[model samples]
Target chain A: MADKKKKKLTPEAQQYQSYQEKREVKRPIFKNCIKAFFVGGTICLIGQAISTFYIYYFDFTEQTAGNPTVATLIFITMFLTGFGVYDRIGQFAGAGSAVPVTGFGNAVVASAIEHRTEGFVLGVGSNMLKLAGPVIVYGVFSAFVVALIKTILIKWGGL
Target chain B: MLVGHQTWMFKNKPTIISTGTVGGPFEANGRIANDIDILHDDMWIKQDSFEKAQRTMMEEACQIALKKTDVEKEQVQFFISGDLINQITPSTFTGKTLDIPYFGLFSACATSMESLALASSIVNSGGANYILSGTSSHNAAAERQFRYPTEYGGQKPPTAQWTVTGAGCALLANKGTGPVVTSATIGKVVDMGITDRLIWEEQWPQQQ
Candidate 1:
């Protein structure tokens, strides 16, 4: 049986071997890097622009300007979420845009839209806070604990 | 975060004059003043799971304000705050914790700024002394009413903002020892008439 297995390959096997000879192509490294650099840089530039706008137009001090900038970004992201443009940006920017406050707005609006078909009150209204609920809960809870400690200290501790 | 509190010195102790909220009907208290105290107490709206958190944050902010100033919680003449939640839970909870003469307000996101303005005016006019004014927002609660939840992986637009999931409190003393609220400006709501709900496009533009 072992000697018999050494026979020459049939023509059918040779034909199959020839079919698998296609070459694999590689993407240009420079092009990929250039694209990444521009896209990433553009996001940073937008953030800078927002900060400047708040400072110059709103008369906000440098420190306080961050609030307005975040507000503006949120507003923009909300509109985009409604128009269905933000999802694409998220894909490209990865966490660049999603890590900010604007990302939170996008999550809320998008989820609302997803559940809108369920009806106004039950669908959209009920599901609206699904994504942002934790932030509110934790934010409030943390603050409450702080207040409790402060109250105790002021009331009895005399600090 | 600063865990400890510090006291400031002044020749005369500053008194809390007034406190107010924006998202409610105004009462006629005709008085003039040079400076006003305002707190952004109404900025956060409440939702079901967020009730406990809102109360907690309001209490913390108020505590910070009280601890920083010499006034005791009982000595506080009034506590003013508001939100868009049912019965104004944030403000109500805050009132219960502080256990002072309290007023609830509602004005959506503008609550905090509006409250600060009112507090400033009261302090300048000598209505009361040592007023505690503050505002808070919980992302979870506000999103439930206004948007969506965290489990959803839905896309977001560039314009939307993650509501600050935190609370801020300030002490309003008439003596002008600490940083005094200088002015409060009210902003009117404006709609840009954007009918396109799907403003953010879901696809990235392909590189040409």
Candidate 2:
């Protein structure tokens, strides 16, 4: 039978396995949540600051300023991605770095920069979408579906 | 009650035979750069990915630690290490190459001391004759995963901290001719009654 022939680890191997289990550190879920919460909120606070900039300086109302604010944030993020500044913030903030629209820009430009040596078409163009691929695909599809439902409600339901 | 409430003292003195440190260019230019055992001029370490480079440095640090002493990699009982990246991938991947028993740890900034303490305890307990304790963090890789890429020109506020780029490994043996591990007290868990209503409970409210 296979059971009789089954081999066991040598003493050293057994001890090694035992030590690995005994000494391993567990992930700190609550601590990480706190870090992510503050860092993420800070990123949002930056976004709000940018939105306010557009509203106060450009004479756009707060409600109307959101559109340009997102664009401005993404623009700043892209530049920060280029200048190597965002990364320092990301290191301290962790999830704070990824929770903003800026993070999406960072992801795209990061992969592009990482793969720049591979040439534009094959490297930057392709790799930029690699992480964003799923998000963008689902985003468009969901939007289309939602728009279709809205049209149906407005036309057929006569609401 | 003794020196500090958070510190624990190991019964046995775990001597550190040797240490291996690998630093990138920035650290190479630091005050202790000349003191580093091995220094790489480039952050990539000629690897395709920053994370991979971190792994290579960590492995090299371990190898150097073992090499400094008569102990072969095979003779080492275990590797206790981790990194700043998600999942502590660099340390875990290096563990794969070392092919020794490994305990992937993540204590963020304090990981180096944390591993040393744990290794001392294990060796002191007679669980093993030798253990490797270390941690590594790459400037570029840590930033990429946690913040922004190198190219991002975001202006850092005056208070922002910098990542420590390099790996530091120490070889702890039951008997050796070096500094010994005396005692290690674990950290304290403080609760300020900041409740579940705080969405970002993992982080402090104000940190730039």
Candidate 3:
């Protein structure tokens, strides 16, 4: 795609683009992946511990412990976001912090606090889902599509 | 007046008679804190919104510049300023408070220098006797406009710039006993066909 776009540029612009490309900073994708793996794994480990705790301490079974565990993680994330610590963690962890339920919590809480000055109804309430709204919309849509495919396979394609 | 294709050689040599610099807590903790005339303990500067805070800081910087030279607000003929905000509202509000004939510029990171250049050119050409040249930028306000909210969790590349929460202004005059502006060169836009907002990879030591 980039090459296709580059072909349309003027000779001077193309030359400059190539020159810039040589000097451009390459993203440390390998390092980021490693960091994300460890950090994301650690977050999942904590979530598992929370789930186990709910299962063992409370009367809840393994099947019913997921909701409380997610809520707990989000609550923790809300505190971290309010204290301005989660942003720093996010800077270090990249997608590790982002691709988790905690990240969604941070998005809502951060936007809420950020636009509070504009008033509650217009500012905090409306803009609260600005960042997380897309994630929710698409997440549910993708799940629905997957569920539809599963139902079609079960109903039409004999087991 | 016109020196080269993009340069201007000022004959009058407009002088920066006085200057005022305001900074937030982050800048206050920096090495050049001593040079800052007014350093606020908080980023908000007691304003309700970050935009309002930015405006207040700009006004404070302009006021300090005027006070240092004992120049009356009426004496300053022109106020040239800019910022990174959408529509440069902080600078406009500062102009409204200073109540001077205003010229709002938008040069992003180069706003301060651009304003100074224009202010000097105007004073040098006898278009204005006194000019206040300055720029203000709040980190939060700039982030809200250009990037994300202050509390948003996102990783920025090493080359990403931090929008400083501060304001600085210089009182330039046609005749004074201080640093003189001799020339000004306006920049030209050069597009390199690169659409990536984030660029500039760090060259390793081995490469160097």
Candidate 4:
């Protein structure tokens, strides 16, 4: 059905709906906000620490360290997902864990782990991207579009 | 092995005299809360670990059945119970407390029905007057074993089942006012080509 029709009032159905609404517990928005802030901030802090470490140890410029720092974060998240620790953090932190690139890495690795039973080709290769595919597609396409716009502005508008 | 699809046909009808059930807070908040004999406030059951909590529920369920019919612990011949824990420790520990002749079983979710079938066959054949058959699965304990830890907050796919943290036990005897078990059939293992773990987990329960 495209849309559910408005049905005639049944006394029992009305009573049941009312009961369900009454029993529903309200979500604590403030607590959730606090949790998300702390967890997301912690992830960013760790990323900054990694970037700083790379700049100092590898003698890299602040500009060059960004790529390696992201790789490191994703690497760390993948391992944590494998070891079954990232999921715990994800649970405790909710959106805090999800907003970071690490969460994306966790999602990809978690799906791979889940589908490992179906063999490498069909299971790991195919299903690994099942959850991560859409995000990646949009990311690449948007980046391409931005680059195209930049080129068009530089060419036609004469810088 | 001389067995060829061997099935047990009992001469006497085994009756479920009394049943005892215990559930976690999740089930207590569920629609069928009133149906459960005992609804626990928390999953831990005042125990230190999830494993121990599962054991307490299992033992409590048997105790409830025994208490309802005024049957002494010593009078009940067997404690055929199991839980979704490593080595079936909950059943083992509960058996230790009951001090009854135990047959610790492990058939995952099917343990409840399997144990009932086994107990009914034994009772019908004059093995014992009363036997307690029970099985339990703590959501935390099961998630820790078969999947990730409960604290992990891992998002499960739609096919993933919520492991019900509850224990249910029934005392089967030759005469009782409850439902009677006329016959029992042991199942054979059949594997289909369903490759997904979540799908497999969901399918196994439905098959039973």
Maximum-TM-score candidate: 3
Best by DockQ: 3
Tens digits of lDDT, candidate 4, B1-208: 1134766666688899999999999999999999899999987789767778898998899889888997788888888988778899999998999899999898888899999989998898788999999998898777656764342334344345689999999999887688998767788764322234443233221000
lDDT per residue, candidate 3, A54-158, as tens digits?
Answer: 999998899999999999999999999999999998888878887888888888899899989989999999999877777778778989999999999999986
Which of candidates 3 and 4 is the stronger one according to DockQ? 3
> A17, model 3: CA deviation in Å?
3.9
The predicted structure with the larger lDDT, 1 or 3, is 3
Writing each residue's lDDT as its tens digit, candidate 3 over B1-208 gives 9986999998998999999999999999999999999999988888899999999999999999889887799998999999988889999998988899999999888999999999988888799999999999998887877676678777776556788989999999999889999999999877777663532122100110
Tell me each candidate's TM-score.
0.43, 0.58, 0.90, 0.59
Q: Report the candidate with higher DockQ, 1 versus 3.
A: 3
Residue B57 accuracy (lDDT) in model 4: 91
Considering only chain B, report the TM-score of each candidate against the true chain B.
0.67, 0.87, 0.91, 0.89
DockQ of each: 0.04, 0.08, 0.39, 0.08
Task: List clashing residue pairs in candidate 3.
Answer: A25-B201
* Prediction RMSDs, each to the true structure: 29.4, 13.7, 4.9, 12.2
Candidate 3 chain B, run of 10 with poorest lDDT = B199-208
TM-score of chain A of 3: 0.90
lDDT string, candidate 1, B33-124, tens digits: 11222233332334234556666667766776676555678776777787766678878878887888886778877887667666666666
List clash counts for every candidate, in order: 77, 29, 1, 1
Ranking by lDDT: 3, 4, 2, 1
Winner by DockQ between candidate 2 and candidate 1? 2
